[model samples]
Target: MTDDADESSTSLLPEPLRTVTPLTGSHRDESMDVIGWGIFLGLVVLLLPLLPFILIVWLISKVTESLTPS
Candidate 1:
């Protein structure tokens, strides 16, 4: 059937995402900026998820410390 032929032809086609250019020259400088931002962003993202847990733990310790008589 023509449907089978079309499927086969489409399967043989290369994906369009293979045309990536390597970083070089000023592009390399821009890439380093991007990498720096990426790392910073990753750290912020990681911290955000832990922030609430950290705050809760701090609050619990403070409350317990106040309640405990010396």
Candidate 2:
């Protein structure tokens, strides 16, 4: 039997979740390492200062959550 999906059924997916988009990668010598590290370091720089604050808030919330009767 042929394995083929219905085109109308595929259209039910949201735009971002759809696989119909074309592969338009950059036409340059851009290594994936450069892109990966750029995103990783960018997030670190943005979130480093907030990490301690987030941890403290999370700890407090977890403690409160545990103390509350189930």
Candidate 3:
């Protein structure tokens, strides 16, 4: 009949999935955003050029393997 009863029923849920508090802006999240973007961009810069060579090598391997007798 009350919100307490509703909450008691929801206790069956996992603790992490339960809404314990309202979301708030976190400095740690903001710092992580900066670091995440840096790592993402670093990976992009490092891998973008390698992608073509990787694909070419992969294609060549597949072609050679297919051409070779089983």
Error of 1 at 21 (Å): 24
| Model 1: residues with Cα > 4 Å off, grouped in runs | 1-30
Each candidate structure's TM-score, on Cα atoms with residue i matched to residue i, is 0.49, 0.49, 0.55
Give RMSD to native, each candidate.
9.4, 14.7, 10.5
Off by over 4 Å in 2: 1-30
Compared with the true structure, model 1 gives a TM-score of 0.49
- Model 1: colliding residue pairs: none
Summed backbone clashes in each candidate are 0, 0, 0
Local accuracy by lDDT, each model: 0.89, 0.85, 0.90
Candidate 1, residues 1-70, lDDT tens digits: the string is 9999889988866767755787566435787899999999999998999999999999999999999998
Model 3 residue pairs with clashes: none
TM-score of 2: 0.49
**Span of 10 residues, lowest total lDDT, candidate 1:** 18-27
Residue-by-residue lDDT tens digits, candidate 2, 1-70: 1234566555666666656878888686568779998999999999999999999999999999999999
